[model samples]
Target chain A: MKRWLPSSLLSGMLFVLWLLLNQSLDPAHLLLGTVLAVVAPLLARTLMQPIGYPRLAKPIILIRLLGMALVEIVHSAITVSRLILFPKPDGMNSQFIKIPLDLRNPYGLALLSCLINSTPGTVWVEILPNRHELVLHVFDLHSEQWWVDTIKTRYEKPIIDIFHEEVHKENPP
Target chain B: MNEMETIPLWAAALLVSLLILGGSIILIGALGLMRLPDFYQRIHGPAITVTLGAGCVLIASMLYFTVLQSRLVLHELLITVFVLMTAPIVSMLIIRAAVYRDLRARKRDSGVESGGIYRFPEQE
Candidate 1:
């Protein structure tokens, strides 16, 4: 079962999604959704990177983290909206700064980008393949070092801990 | 529309407020897009606002459906999760592409060297 269902969560989601979209629990729909759910992950396994079981290991931490994210997202949106409404046509400062990345896991990096983009006033500009340097653009550039520290400590550490646990478990050192 | 009366007064009020909040957030974001300076700055408007706006709207919808049908209706969660997952990826792509174009346009002089460092084009 484990070998066949490399991403059981994804497959389960597909099954639920199929049923929800069709809005039916008829035997036909169930059978079709089950077949698709079981086979889709297996066929798509080659294209998917094996990010070992992205699950909520610590429920408390996950809840707290989500709460923080929701608050931050709302606050940032309000701040950006204010800036937009108050400022003249070109009153904002925008520039890219490169920060050193401590989290090297692919899933963690992906999450970092997602969080950064989800927050207003910051965008992930680029990252070098060879180097662990991540470039990001911010709407307000009060202090470059401040952004770097905040990002590394607030966002990167938790993400690294979350995803790196998988890496740690996979390849015990 | 008929479900309006079926929904409790408080629930209906809450739903309307949530929907209003979501729509206003999206509207503010649109306003930002029109007013902000550059492509990069403007992108923030839609990217962030849409996430929260859609989130609020989805929550309202979930509340609504649950009340109406008297069962936990959660197709809204699927849409919320999808938007949250994809919005950031889309933002990253847009920013990266914008920055690349900006660099290229700004540095038409240096013969295609990115910030004095030559990056080999992707083989793939």
Candidate 2:
């Protein structure tokens, strides 16, 4: 099973995506999709680095995090639109702010970055080298502390919980 | 044209609203690009279009095709997934490039000096 489906989830998604793109359930398409799904992941596996696979310990938490991110995306989209439409006389306090991150797992960090960048008014600029801090650009800055607190508690905590093993392995406690 | 008449009233209403909403959001995002002062702020404008605007348009497409063809046409979801997956990476790369360029030139708003990420020549 492992040999046939190196990553079952990936294969499943690929197959579904193939079917959707073709917009067909014909046997020929089904066969082709199945073959493509199996082959694609195998090809990808070779190109990928030997980073440890992200084990999602708490699927529910991951889902909740994604849900929260969607809401945030919508909320910020509106806020950004408002700011754009009605610019303040003095101009918006757009600035770059750094947030210290506790979630060290690469997958968690990747997800967090994706969530932050997807939401309007926040851009993931870069992760500062030699420190576990993320440099982000905020479209409108009101309170730096609020951004830091929100990112640490709301986003990072859940991600840490979801990717618990990696953190535990690194910390050894 | 004949197929257009087949779409139910409720579906038509919903589709029209979604398209209008999506169009307006995208328009605002474009306007934001023109109005914003700096590179960082300008980058955000497209983020809204990529997330909410594209999402609305894709959903509207899904609804229209589903109602017209009388089948579950969800291929638009693939576009959504691809867009969501790729947009951040693109923005991240662009922002990184902008930061690198700004820092090299020692621009005031680059945040390199004040951000403490990189030390300037004078600071060194």
Candidate 3:
């Protein structure tokens, strides 16, 4: 079963999307979607071999992250709105800061970038892989320490917990 | 307090809030793009519009349609989920490309920070 359907979830989603898109249960749509679902992943498999299954223990933590991010977006919008309306020629401290990262997991790193970039006033600029540092541009550079702390406490820790590194992750409760 | 009161006030209220929230979020995101100091900072700004802004509007649509039809009308949920997943990938790729360009430019401009991750060692 696993051999035939490399990604069962992908196949299922593809089938569903095909149905929804066509808004019909016609024989032709089913055949085409099924063929696409099977063939596309198979083609993709040649280019990219699938990785080992990921450790997704704490689902609640991910939900919490989403909630936190939404709130941050709202807060950031208001702050940016104020900054724009009242031009802060002197008050605003715009600069780039390099954040050192310990989590080496590619997926974790990707999540970290999304978290940082989605929030207003900050952008992921450069990632120095050799040094394990991410260069981020911030609209208001209140303190370098603040940015470092925020990234570590808010994003890195949760990602590490969620991704579950064999050697790095602590035993979850 | 109008004579035409077929639809519930709660539904009307939800739709109003949804549009308001969605529109404002988009506005702020665009404003962020203009207000931000540099190109890198501007990249993060539109994500607000992509995620939360679109999310609120979609939810509103889902709610309105479902209530009107008296059934669980979804499908917008798929778009919301799709956007949520895709936005990060797009942002990372763009940022990576931009950083590469910046690093290359720096190497051309100043003959320093060479052999770092930002730069490859020149062949002799």
Candidate 4:
């Protein structure tokens, strides 16, 4: 299975995306999509690093994480818009917060970075190589500890479950 | 096109409202870029527009197209997905460069005679 489908999730996503993009269930389209989905991953497999196995404990957990992340994204957009619209430079402390990452998987780290960046106010700045530490810049930095706790608990934990071994997770989400 | 008038009143209302909300959110974000004092703070504005505002606009488009054509017209979602994937990368690179430039400038300004360095300054 691993030999044939080096990246099952990627292949599946590519297949679905192909279908979605073409928007046709015709046999020809299906055949083409299947071929592309199979061949593309195979061709691109060498380029991708061999991560042991992308962990997805449960679909429900991932759905819940995405749902929570979506809500936070919306809420932060509103909060950031308000902060931007109402100028209060003195009160707003835009600063970078460094976090020591327990989640080390490449896929997991990418997802976490996307979540952090997409949510209006927070941007993942730099990650120290060799050391599992990340620097994130927050638009409204009221408390450093709060940002640390939120990123670790709310985002990183779920990601670790989604991509790392269950036993390895610091705080199981 | 006559297709505009043919769209149901409720669908039109929903479409218009979503587009308006998305546009206004983007506008607010642009305003943030203008109003923000520092470079770090200014980046937040575009972040709002890309994630939430683009999402809203894309959702509205999906609604409009699907209702008008009467099929699962969700290919437009590709834009949202693409934007979601790309926004962070662009920002990350820009910020990395900014930080790099800022650090070198700081080192230069302080008149520190440092050896050849080829690494990102650790954010502490």
Candidate 5:
């Protein structure tokens, strides 16, 4: 049973989603959804094969991250709106800044991209593998160093903690 | 004139305006899809519809239904949540596929990475 249903949380969420979508207490729908909830992942299990599960040791940190993200969203929204409504004299100073990263885990990199892209003023432009640099575009850049510091301190460290990887500490040029 | 009960004039006006605004924005987004010159620029156009247009319509739905039902009916929230979560994924997949196809075509056309460094090409 453990081998077959490796992710209890995922399976439970799938089952709940099935019920929410069906929206009926009818036995037929319940039985059908249950079958789907179990069988779908079972069928999917062969595709990539499961990797080792991370311990997920930091729930408090994750909550703090969520709070910080919500605050950032509001702040970034105001900044972007101002830029959109009133064109800056220099226009948008869009430049690709490459920040060297030590976090090599695939999942950590994915989370970093999601955080960067979800923020209004920034976009994750690219990641250069051979050089271990991730490129980002900022809508407003008073100082390149500030952006690099914010990314490393606010987003990257939390991800590193969650994913548990050694990342090299480097100052942006 | 008899004081017949009707939706408060202001409420009716607000609902109508919101519905129109939502519909028009969605239409404009669709139009942008055709009018924009390139794939990347065109992609940004639909974000307006998905974010603001859908938001307007959902708010209108919530407002209209709450008034009618005398209590909040929030089934519309599922639609909003699903759209919000899924739209980015859909957009990313489409962009990635388009980039991959362009790179493949470029390679066959010139057999060089001179165009740019593609992170995950079709071959990968």
Candidate 6:
């Protein structure tokens, strides 16, 4: 099973996406979707990094994180709308800040970046190469420490828990 | 169209409200791009459009079709998924390019000197 389905999660998503795109439950579509799902991942496997598959140690945490992110997105959308409609006389305080990251799992970092960027007021600019710090640009700067704490506690902590990178670090293969 | 009659009143109302909400949100996002003073802040404008705005319109489309056809029409989900997956990457690249350009010119807001991610040519 491992040999054929290198990433079962990805394969399943691809299969479902194929069927949905076709908008059909026909047997022919099912057969074609299955074949494409199996083949596409295999072909793309060479491009993937050697990092071990991300194990969802706690799936519930991931779901909760997504839910929280959705709420944040809506909340920030309103905040941003207000900011745009009613401009500050002195101009908005937009600035770049760096947050140190403890979650070393590439997948976790990717998800964090996506989540941050998806929110209206924040963007992930870059990661410091020498240091495992994320450079983020904030549209409005209220307090530097607050943003750092929020990113660390609210976002990074849950991702770290879900990925369980500490276990990987402890027992390296 | 005859198909328009197939949708229930509640569904049609919901669809219209969602579309209006989404369009207003997108309009605000576009206004941000023009109103924001700097590039970094400007990029954030479209983030709203990509996330909640697009999401609203897509959900409305899905509901409209599902109600019209009397079936589960979810291909719009593919658009949502693809947009969510790719929007960040595009913004990330654009921001990086802008940073590199600003850093080369020794601009104040590049944050390269403070960020310590990439060394400025003067430092090198």
Task: Give native contacts recovered, as a fraction, per prediction.
Answer: 0.55, 0.78, 0.24, 0.76, 0.00, 0.71
lDDT of 3 by residue, A3-91 (tens): 66766656777888877777667999999999988877666665544343234567689889878988887787667666755767765
Worst 10 residues of 4 chain B by lDDT: B111-120
The lDDT for every candidate, in the order shown, is 0.76, 0.85, 0.71, 0.79, 0.63, 0.86
- TM-scores vs. true structure, each candidate: 0.84, 0.90, 0.74, 0.88, 0.64, 0.91
- The alpha-carbon deviation from the true structure for residue B109 of candidate 1, after best TM-score superposition, in angstroms, is 8.2
4 or 6, which is superior by TM-score? 6
Give the DockQ of candidate 1: 0.41
**Per-residue accuracy of model 4 over B40-123 as CA lDDT, tens digit each:** 778888888888888889999899989988888989877878998999899988887876777776665331122222223233
Which regions of candidate 1 fall more than 4 Å away from where they truly are? A25-31, A49-63, A88-90, A169-173, B108-124
DockQ for model 3 equals 0.26
Which whole-number lDDT from 0 to 100 does residue B71 have in model 6?
91
**Model 2, runs deviating above 4 Å:** A166-173, B107-124
Evaluation by lDDT, superior candidate among 5 and 6 = 6
Docking class of 3: acceptable
Model 4 CA deviation exceeding 4 Å by range: A89-91, A166-173, B108-124
How do the residues B1-124 of candidate 2 rate in per-residue lDDT, one tens digit apiece? 9889999999999999999989999999999989787667789898889999999999999999999999899999999999999999999999899778767676555454345754232232
Q: Encode model 1's per-residue lDDT on B30-91: one tens digit a residue.
A: 88888775676788889657777888889999999899988878888778888998988888
Q: Compared with the true structure, what per-residue lDDT tens digits does model 3 show for residues B1-124?
A: 3423555789989889999989987887788778766665567568678876887899999888777766677778778778877776677678677766766765553421332333222211
- TM-score between candidate 5 and the true structure: 0.64
The first chain of model 4 has a TM-score of 0.87
Whole-structure CA lDDT of model 1: 0.76
Question: Over the stretch B77-112, how does candidate 5's per-residue lDDT look in tens digits?
Answer: 778767766665666566556655765765653312
Report the candidate with higher TM-score, 3 versus 6. Answer: 6
- State the lDDT at B14 in candidate 6: 97
Q: Candidate 5: lDDT of A81?
A: 45
Q: List each candidate's DockQ score.
A: 0.41, 0.60, 0.26, 0.50, 0.13, 0.56
Q: Which one is best on TM-score?
A: 6
User: On a 0 to 100 scale, what is the lDDT of residue B108 in model 4?
Assistant: 50
Q: Over the stretch A50-163, how does candidate 1's per-residue lDDT look in tens digits?
A: 555455345466556667877888898888877877885646666667788888777667777877888888888668656668877788788989998999888887776666
DockQ of model 6 vs. true complex = 0.56
A1-173: candidate 5 lDDT, tens digit per residue:
86777556557667767766766568888888778777777777666354432334565776788679757854664455444445567444544466778777665776676556555556565566456777654555688888888888998888878756322222123
